[model samples]
Target: EYLHFNLFKENKDTFEANTIITRLLGLRTGASSVTFAGTKDKRGVTVQRACLRCVDHERLATVNQRLQGIRLGTFAYAKEPLRLGQLKGNRFTIIVRQIQPTAAAATLAGDALRAALQKRVIDEFAEKGFVNYFGMQRFGTRDIGTHQAGILMLAGQWQETINLIMAPKSGESATITAARAQWAEHHDAKAALAMGFSSLYGSAERALLQWYARHPELRHDPHAALFSALPRNLRTMYLHAYQSWIWNQIVSIRLDRYGPTARKGDLVLVDPAVDDVDDELVSAVDAASAAPKEDADAVPRVAVRALTAEEAAQTSMFDVVVPKPGWNVTYPDFLLPHYQSLMAQHQLDPLDMRRKWHECSLPGDYRHVLGRPRDVTVAFQRYTDPQRPLVPTDLDQITEAPTKFRAAPAPFQALPDVGPYDALILGFTLGTSQYATVALREIVEAD
Candidate 1:
């Protein structure tokens, strides 16, 4: 049996936190033994369900005592393991502080006017939804982004791909950056592994370097072998990020040409029972690729069709669909030309996306061009100390901590105190693959 626990973390990414827990439990298999519904942001406190297979409960009790930034609670045994995108949806309580308007929006700067504008935005988003563009976080902060590595992988530039993955970036410590620079200059796997990089962010590089050190024979041409040595999920992330980039470009074009309104050749989901579109319901079927072979039957099969000009008139923004760029997906007739042009810029052919590497071969999937947030609520508050938290986290409520409602020092609190700053607390539920950051972008009108 597996043990399920509610994981609460502040200022830690889901992957990094899971790695620490894995090591603490002495799980030699590492990340393969742990599972979570979805990844959460590292900047804020987030509560989510996670599971570890065949774990000793006694060891889990020590985690709370040992870990500083993480908390584990409400443990239970379950028959099944938690998989990515397995949850119905995520409930978020996000706090946006130091509210200020842009030059364009500065004319209406009073509290009442700002409140009215926010209300209008929330109401419009609730009804028609905002553009479901991939957030900036999907691509890494480096000049050579994750999607660029994906492009290189697909194009069979293995050396270039590995170089991109191991390249050093800004904001890293001198030692870590030096290690990466050493690898770049010498390509000496044994030398790089000897230096050691046990940091949370250095796991991928360490794994790849270790593989090369063990198999010195493959060091001369270690692209395919090196790529294969890494975990499946990590490889999949690169391809997914590339697909997301293409989807973002295509969706932006579609929205610019046809806002909210469905076009003649736009694609929409069709259920056998309901001949027309099901605009009100968001299905949990977009995560087909994320599911394992054992869970194939659990994924629901969704059918889609191109809308006729007459049928298009009856549909709403939720009815429009965009292809995630793969060999298996069908692009909307109206957007096919745009997809071809965009793919050509990267020397890729969207018509035939098959690659020799299984990780690079994307089968494609469909996602709604727009996503609506459910059970949404917005409230404004005035706070004296910016270091204090405006919303209570799940751990606070679970532990019944007296400080739940009181002002406490928090991590990563950098909001300057321009006295009497307004804090916007938003409570909403969003389905899997939907970005809360993107939703916030719509509310704040941020670039």
Candidate 2:
């Protein structure tokens, strides 16, 4: 049986949290034993369900004490280990700091003004919902977007793809950044490995450097050998991110062209019963290696179909979807021209995503055009200190221990008088793949 636990983490990414647990449980057993439903942001406090194979509750409970910013509890046994896209949704309690008054609200003062602004935002969001454009986080905050690397990969540019992946970034350590800069300028793999990388962040770069070090001359399967050094998910993520980039732009075009309402030739799910539709992609490496099977049950449970004008008239924005752009998926007839035009700009053929290297071959998926949060609740509060805790975490509620987990303050009540800063405590539940940041953007009208 899999030992399931509720993982509460503050300011740590999913990979960091999982790595800590893997060591405590014994890493020799393998990192694959630890699994989670989804990845959460590294900026804030997040609580999610996770499962570990071949671990006991007592040993798992010990992890809570060993960890500083992480806590594991609510232990139990399950028949299956947690997999990606396993959760129905995520419940978020976000504190939007430094809430500024709009030009219209400049004249109004204190709680009266707060009430007016809150009601306006709540009412509009409840009715219209937000555009389901993928957040900027998906593309990454870098000079070269992740999708650019995928484009190079698909076009059969191995050296360029590797160089792009090894490019220096703003926040990395000086030593590693210098090493990357040297590699970018000199293209010397041996020199990069000689510099040494001890930080976990440089793990992928180190692996690639090491690979290139051994094979000074790339003669056979160089691309496959280099790519195989990275994790399967990381390798596949480049292609997926490329799809996301296209999807985001197309969704914006759809909104601008036809507005939020459903239109003729828009795609919808073939099986409306499947609400938790997720992009469950197999690694191209795995797909290429495994023998082709003819199992009828292996077909996707949720397929898409375009709507007729008559059917479109009866459809809601919620039912409408846009293709992620793959060989298998169908694009809307009206938007096909726009899609082709966009692909042409990148020197890619939209109809054919297949490449000589199997890793670049993509089978696309679909995403909803609009995302609306469920049971959304918002409140405003005035605070003198920005460092104060805004919301209590899951660990704060259950345990009374004197650890940092017990230090969280309760949600601040709205006051009549104005303070130094205004804060918005927003709570909502979003379905799988829906971004909480996107929902907030609709209310705040911020980029």
Candidate 3:
């Protein structure tokens, strides 16, 4: 029989064991393992509780030092694992310990989560001497501006963690000394169930538990009770659907250029909210990864279709459309003649349009607004001074006049009568959903 046990500071007295089990399990960091080694069942208590202990203050302290360096959430892991009585508490000490994983492996939940757990462990032991189990946030910033350097540090903390993984040596003391961040995230996730902070794990636990179910051996465990109240299948569908929502929102904001589209359990570290604080991090990653976010180079070269002799002065809405390079300027069937006029006024030569020419970027791509509705999209359209951005369209067309009707002034051109190219097509929903996609991108990437 397998017993998942968590150990903690037991007041030096064995009987008062369950006192803080709730707190221990609430942490969102670190890995824990429990084995029945052998249970000494006594008659004093009844509600099943777990028996576990902290590994060592030094190991924990080392982790804490690493945590202070990066600055996300890391205070939880310093405590011990919390044990729940598989059998209602009858006082008994279950031999349990924190072990390390063998290899660098990926856990679908994501790496930011693992770093979170490590941060907790480090904090718990910081009272004593230590070394970082989570590695360092040190990265080169020779070209980044001074202000951007600080922003890069803040934002790239997670991205830089891509290097912090502790590869357990044969002589290492822990089970998984420093497994891949993903593995720690999963292990910590299971450990966190013992903690009271279960709500923080809403979607993650469901996905992991489902993955655990694939192994018939663990499937029968009572842990299934955690999700029994929800639909039998809702657990499986949560992640994918959530990710789809995220991708849709990001697409709507035009921030799908970053690591967009999430599957049920895919690992994504780009959060738009953080971008505001560390805007340069995204730029740094993008600059290094080439123009991956825009994949501007990937568009296939399509042969331009020449207008037919009779179609030269075409009458159809689509007829007026001349596919411009790099612009999403297709004339949808829904476009009206009034829109053409709007488009002409909106149009500018190549140098005048910074975005289409790949001239600028939002602080971050919007990932948070996924599945959620957005009312508007904003961006720095003129790019240069006046420096004012423009609102291409109301995503929902919900804004009232004067209240939300204020749009940035654009330098008007002598445009021919035409339809609006920069308009919203709500009959169909886009992933980002708005023409001024920068805000949509912002929305999509929000925490």
Candidate 4:
């Protein structure tokens, strides 16, 4: 049986949210039984659907009551589990705050000028879609070393991966910073093992340390042992992050080659159910590889095929799809040079990506070259600082008012005077695997 819940999470990642719910339900099957369409941002308030197996109403209620920073809005039983990329799209209501007029227009009139600028930006986005670049969140915020570690892992450099994972970053906690410093200074298995036992070290780091402590003789071939010690999800993530980085580079190159449009040799993705034998084989292989590890009963598949001259004529109606490099994945002839150059730059061969560990192997996937937001609407409003009095100009009069006036202030206080700052409220919807943050970047031009 499948159970669905409306998850409202604030400042929490999807993994942490799932972990909380799994613990609250007291399900022996653990987190693997729960599934979600996609992950939401950790720093924002997001509402999305999630599913679990063999959960009842009572347990769900207990979960809602026990969990903090997450509230269940709706609950129902489903005949099937919610698989990844199952959603049609997500609706976003984002408030862009601290907006200021451009320097050229700063001297112009008050709110009107800011509002016009905001509208112009929104209109530009509506006319031309934003660059579909992967946001920085895909990499670690503090370290930004996941892709580097992934590169090392793929190259069979185990010690380097360990170093990258345990290295000290600028804003780490005191304990972590000190532990990493000790590891960096000594570079000894025994010392690192001792440090990893500390409460500050995460499970993956501790696992590596424990492996080193257990098998000191295998120091020369530590890559295999050290990598095997990490959790399966983490190992998979390392490879996935590397693939994402490669895809990002390729997308940048594609934009340079074909400016905002597709050509005859370009590739486009369509529904996998197309009556093509090659597409079916790709779907089957991806499903077989991913289903067991991800506990996904059903996997969604799409076909990535090169556009013919006839198809390219209507390219604007479809999205250009690029392959996430893998051992078995095929690429169009036109893009082969670019792919080869990128792989050469990283000193990697496609054959080397094949791994004995199935979880770490790439199952081959496709991502669109351009992401366009749908049903976009924007509104502008004057922002006011709530801290000071509603009218800073009238502060002296309020302070000097009579004792009776001070004793009982007016119930309906005047609205705060509008400040120079303006806020932009943007509403839009994006399909699965698309990021709202990426779309917002086109307007704000911030990282």
Candidate 5:
């Protein structure tokens, strides 16, 4: 080893709290960062450890189980004699680069990106994974963090307030602001995968491409305030179910969330549980349009009036049936503990869970190891949320019939030909040592 050579810390950890306003500030006060010191080798030496912990989920045993499983694979077993190497023992010199970001101006901007990322990720995960709005069980987990982070990054500083106002519509719509805030989210997902779960990888990849499909010009919706003001939880559920039943009974895809472009319509005030939410929206839009105005010169509006606070408080998209997972549901099996375990063991640390969604475990972790390693370099990606592919729509632009879905289609790539092209004549030679090597790899990888 050279004495005078300069060195740099390869693995740098970064994060930003993704919560409502007050919580974000709390993070700047060191809500997520903490130091823990434990004895080394059962001797009188003190060791310093810096760790990230979610205060909300900390006390929850489920959450603790999750964190411990992660630490085992990443720090304690990430090297050596394979099985016993579940954590990286004593290789890395702990260096903490901590910063607190405060930018209230970016609130609106951050939300837009979050929603867009959520929709694309959820939609693509369900479409490419199991049918019928599957959940985390499908192949999406691996990239959830990365995909979310990537979306945040892609959002960056909006060119204008309009861009911020028009960002995508989903849970992520407001999760963050400033594209630079994504690194933390990206690493979180990557960390999950490294610990041993990769089932979510497929879902994450599809989400990445789906988000790519939208141009930044398509960010806002005039009707967003109306939707945002909608109610939550069970109230939204009953209304959504009724809407889905009606829309599905008529249209093809469930239209609980279609825009005026996709749903040309009228406006009306009616109970969502009784009246179909889709039809009610349609009627409301129509009535609002046809309502006589005092001045003929008055500018026409894109969306109608906002729901009363009472009405808004009653509107939600999540359902009670959610997560009731039936038999064979992939719950804790593929994405959690195991995936996290592997990452911990492999010393595969994700750089930023909030940004750079496409990168696997951070670049540095791949190089240094202090334990017995497993097979995965990155966990598989797979997860699903039914509330995906949401497009923001302006209330004024509702001329009926979505001009949105008419965009150019994505390119499709076909896999190479497989199996024997002939019957018995060619088949006999095919399995006989010729394709044995190929078959062997498939068997190994598929499991």
Candidate 6:
């Protein structure tokens, strides 16, 4: 039986949450036994559905007892496990704090100006949808973004991929930084393996180093070996990150040229029954090559067409789709040139993505060019500090006052101080692939 439950996570990403759950259950099952709909931000309080295969209520209850900053509830059984992007959407309650007006405007209107500006920002977002650039979280927190590493992998530059993975990025843990530094100086797999990593954070790096130690004969071809040692999900992530980056650039360019509205040659979704010539070619290749079929259904499919003049006008009501370029996907007529140019800039061809050796081949899909938050509502409230304030200036000299304060504060306690600042509380619902932070960025210009 597949067990489904509502999972509440705080300050953890999906991967971390899964790791914690795995440890709590102490199940010998592999990662595939657990599944989730979509990943949540590492820094937020998020609630989502998750599933564990062949687990019982008593076992789950025991697991729940050991967990902190995570809660599981509303358990049920289902025939199938939860899959990524399988949910309708996510609901969010976000608070934007320390809101204030610009200095120039504040001089003219004071506190009232801050409220006016905040209201205007919300009103504008509710009326006009924001550009759907994949946020920085998608690229990762590293200074050298994950997409850059993905580009190298797609180019069949495995050595470069290994180098990038081993190199230290800003904000990495001390253990990771030291290990990378040692690897950089010597380029000796044996020595690198000997140097123990003190933290569990460098699993991928450790895996790569261990692979190098075991297969010293393939030192010249470390990239292929290194890629093989990495987890399947992580290898796939490289390609996905690259695809997302390309989509972001295309959307930015389109918005700069044509605004948010759709135009002739823009993409519109078509019935999936319609035959896709490109996908058929890919299927033929896969079948003839005898590639694994277990993951075939997970491959993304492109089923869209260019919009005509009349159809383009209706884009405001319909979704405007952009291709996440893959070997089996066809580019829109108007945007094809842009797509080709971008690929060429990266020194890559679309056919180059068919890397069956690593099983990292991408079957591209489509994402909306604009994301509008649904059920959006906003409110303002004075910011208050809940913590006790610093001791009053004369408290040290007033011993009698302290005794009286301690004795008289049974039911008539004074409230905490309220600060001058105000906060904007935004509540909204967005589709599975959409990001609430993206909408927030449109209003607050958040980094």
Strongest candidate by TM-score? 1
Per residue, candidate 5 scores C-alpha lDDT tens digits across 165-278 of 223324432233222133223423233333322222112221222232332233243123212221121112222222222222222121233321111122212333422211
lDDT for position 241 in model 2: 82
For model 2, what is the alpha-carbon lDDT of residue 367?
A: 78
TM-score of 3: 0.17
lDDT of 2 by residue, 210-329 (tens): 666777675245476557666555666677788889988898899898887888889898876655643222222334323244321233434778888899899998888788877657
Query: After superposing candidate 3, which stretches have Cα over 4 Å from the reference?
Result: 1-189, 192-197, 201-206, 210-432, 435-447
- What global local distance difference test value does model 5 have? 0.22
Model 5: lDDT of residue 162: 20
What's the residue-level lDDT of 428 in candidate 6?
Answer: 79
**1-447 in candidate 1: lDDT tens per residue?**
999988888877787778788877777877677799777757657888999988865578666667868887667899999987567777888887877766656666557655765676577767656677777768765576778878888898887777777888788878778788888898787777666564543266877887787787787685755576677666676778898899899888998877658878898867534221222123222344555645433545456799998998998867677878876667787799999999899899899886655456666777778888888887777778877766665667434222323233343344343457787777888776677788777777777
The lDDT per prediction is 0.72, 0.71, 0.25, 0.65, 0.22, 0.66
> Per-prediction TM-score, please?
0.86, 0.84, 0.17, 0.74, 0.14, 0.78
Q: Residue-pair clashes per candidate, as listed?
A: 0, 0, 64, 0, 107, 0
Identify the leading candidate in terms of lDDT. 1
lDDT score, residue 196, model 1? 55
**2 or 5: which has the higher TM-score?**
2
For model 4, how does the per-residue alpha-carbon lDDT over 1-447 read when each residue is reduced to its tens digit?
988877777767776677567766776544456688767767767778888887785567655546677766457898999976466677777767666656756765566766676666667676576666666667656655578877887776777787787776788666666667776786565675555444322245665666666777775676666655665556766776788788888878877876667777777655644422211123333364566754432445445677898888787733666777775556777777887888887797654556665555565566666667788887655547635333222222222323321333354355433666656768887765567788777777667
- TM-score attained by model 5: 0.14
Model 1 pairs in collision: none
Cα lDDT tens digits, model 6, 1-447, are 799987777766776677668766776543445789777767667778889988885577566557777766667899998876466677777766667655546653435765676566667676676766677778777687778878987777888888887777788666667777888987776666666542232245766776777777777886667566675556666767888899888888888877768899887668633323111112222222234656554544546778899988866722677777776666777677788899899997654567645355566766777667778877655546624322221122221222311332223234333566566667777766567777777777566
Q: If both were scored by lDDT, which would come out higher, candidate 3 or candidate 5?
A: 3
